[model samples]
Target: MRPEHLKVLIVDSDANVRELITGWLKADGFHAAAESSGEAAMRRLREEHTDCILAAINLPDMDILELLRQAKLLDPAIEVIMLTSNVADASTVQAMRLGAFDYIVPPLQRESVGLAALKFVKYRNLIDENANLKSGLEAYRKDGDILGRSPTFEQIRHLIADAAATDIPVLITGENGCGKERVARAIHAASSRCSLPMVMVSCSAIPEHRAERELFGSECGAPDGVPYPKRGRLEIAFGGTLFLDHVSALPARIQGELVQALQRQMFRRVGGTLELPVDCRIIAADSADLAALVRTGEFREDLYLLLGAVQIHIPPLRDRREDILLTAEYFLRRICAAMNKNIVDFSEPARQLMQQYHWPGNVRELENAVERAVVVTVSTYIQPMDLPPLQTDPATLPASLSLEELEKRHLLKVLPLMKWNIKKAAEVLGVERTTLYNKIRRYGITRPLRRPSGSVQVPQQ
Candidate 1:
């Protein structure tokens, strides 16, 4: 709602129209600029940050749709309004299809146009606020760099951020490769002990006999052939963080010792009687559900409670499909950088394959796949054949499923990729308009289409 915070660019071939709009916007306390051509408008956009753009649909030198697309590519969150004298159905629909925020017919009324612009700006601000909250939460939860605008991931990020502000031992539970370790690091980074070293001890990594010595220091000349005094992970992590990876793998004896240490803040070194006072924060992660493990008697309940002062559950990548492509792009960039490859983007089929795959191994698998693809891909763009096939098998399908049920699942997976454009979805599926309609009707996939302006309208059945 701060006028200065909102940057608007007005693009029109006619200087008079551009100046008129700019004057009106400036009078209303908005930071507005006017450009006489699409090129000038794009130059301004590139040179400075813009919150939204209002562009004439028919520019002198460039196609309006192309300009709009370029602006969106520059910043996905930037709102764009299309201004044109011709509000034909096709033009309007096409503008909306290309992600224009709103299409305005010329001979613009100052009050009505201003109100509409305000609404668009307000919608954009709400989206930005949600994204900021999500990013903050991701920082707190210690989830690795989050990249998505989806509502679900945003909420998760916010939760992680809130949890990161405390010293309470955090229990992160998720499937393997779900970035649980990244979340632990986020918490450690956000905590007061960030300056101190964070030592990670994988219970599965240490041999059973030496687990105690690994966690607690040992004294010299103590039975193991005059063992020199050595500080354990707990000692090294003093006034810092100790992340226990796969805490459930810890043997019963070590669990008891850890619990005792947590209780007294003191532990006797292995083969020695000296009790060492330790000051450190504990963060534990497990691929399995600790509560379920406790119920099944596979894990100690007291230790679970002690470690799970706060718990964060990360959903699998399949549940948050919105993040898949964003994460893939990030991994692609990283891998390309490492491999010295010029792969800048994925081909259409490659992108579709990525979206269709369920990603059972989660983000880690995606990263590995991208890395492999980067090595194999010879071209600047990665294609479907460059990446490995997904693990979905047709042999696993249910025998009794009707054709309608199968079609619906296929449509559900394809819709997000097409941005929920029914026509585009039909085109991608290689089906006619009426066939797609019948399929939509039969499947009862009646979710309304969402417009770029954040409005929803039901499709005609």
Candidate 2:
């Protein structure tokens, strides 16, 4: 992950120069902090996240060289820019050798010094952002919630950024095992309430009889020996996020109560008189079509609208074919490290098989397959045999396979060969033009530009 936000420290004794650079940095959309002495600047470095430093070559307490050395020792990632009146000085050359980012000579044109500082800020952000991304992926991969690095995944990341920027209820729609919870965690991690607890409620797993008490808690003053009041998932998640998994499974009564709480931003415990404030952010996920459920009156319309106000949909893995092998390799390294195995890479056939097979179970299935492969393989390179055996019977698809995915996968295999000719594809599918068009729209399928030569489609439906 590389750093994006920049904080610059100006350590010049000249208040005019400090104000001058500070204004330039603020205009450039960077945060600037000023210190009159090297000692104060060093203290600031220790307490704050200072990405770049603009230290005057002469300091009140110490030389610029000493400040440069101390700042680098504090955090090597910090890029120090030296501000000086004399480039001809020997100490300036020594400072450069000692790892100064760049030096500024006055006649300090905002254009020149500002440009140099801007350059350092851009470089600093890139470095930090990359470091952060890697760190986040490593943490997520441990939980089998690896977000891939693909164009499609980038768009998903952008959506995630938007979701995290707000506190409104967010609805995550995706097939099973598509990392819905991972996205929820990501939102919570990026939010202002990150330090607080993010309580998760599994709507499908909760017994229907206890759904109310589980979500809204129970009133105190019990008839027998119980003395303390039981806290609910919502109460525990206050000042943070409450993630509802399989939210579509909530009964109609509970759904209505949720809608009321969301509308008023207040909720009361079971058998309680006082209404408690609802302060937590709500994030709900479901594998089912909640809008469809609403149409059938199985889900509350108001609750559906509230939860889905800021919605994110993750397409099945088969739709993101480009990420398949990449994601597989990422898991391969992670799993190998976990297992302490010496396995190197996947064979070409293995890669083709993994990319072609319809990943009905999405990322979770891919991770499990890699873990199983690591366990079974004895050689450095993983062969096709190392992966778990998949049902290859095209004439008889497994009953567990969803029809939507089955047809979408079929269309993907055919459209490339048909060169994405609409009429040709329709004729091949033995469907009318309108029917094929509708299916394409429903599945949100896009045509690939072209396929590589000497490539074979691995057999799996």
Identify the candidate with maximal lDDT: 2
Error of 2 at 149 (Å): 4.4
Q: On a 0 to 100 scale, what is the lDDT of residue 410 in model 1?
A: 71
lDDT of 2 by residue, 313-358 (tens): 8888878888888888988998999999999899998998887787
The 10 consecutive residues of candidate 1 with the worst lDDT sum are: 426-435
lDDT value for model 2: 0.80
lDDT tens digits, residues 364-429, model 1? 767767876898888889988888655453346797878667667777766665567777665455
Locate the minimum summed-lDDT window of 10 residues in model 2.
Answer: 452-461
Clash-forming residue pairs, model 1: 137-157, 137-161, 140-161, 141-160, 142-183, 142-186
> Model 1 off-target regions past 4 Å?
1-143, 391-461
Q: Per-prediction count of colliding residue pairs?
A: 6, 15
**Looking at candidate 1, what is the lDDT of residue 424?**
64
Q: Find the candidate with the highest TM-score and give its number.
A: 2
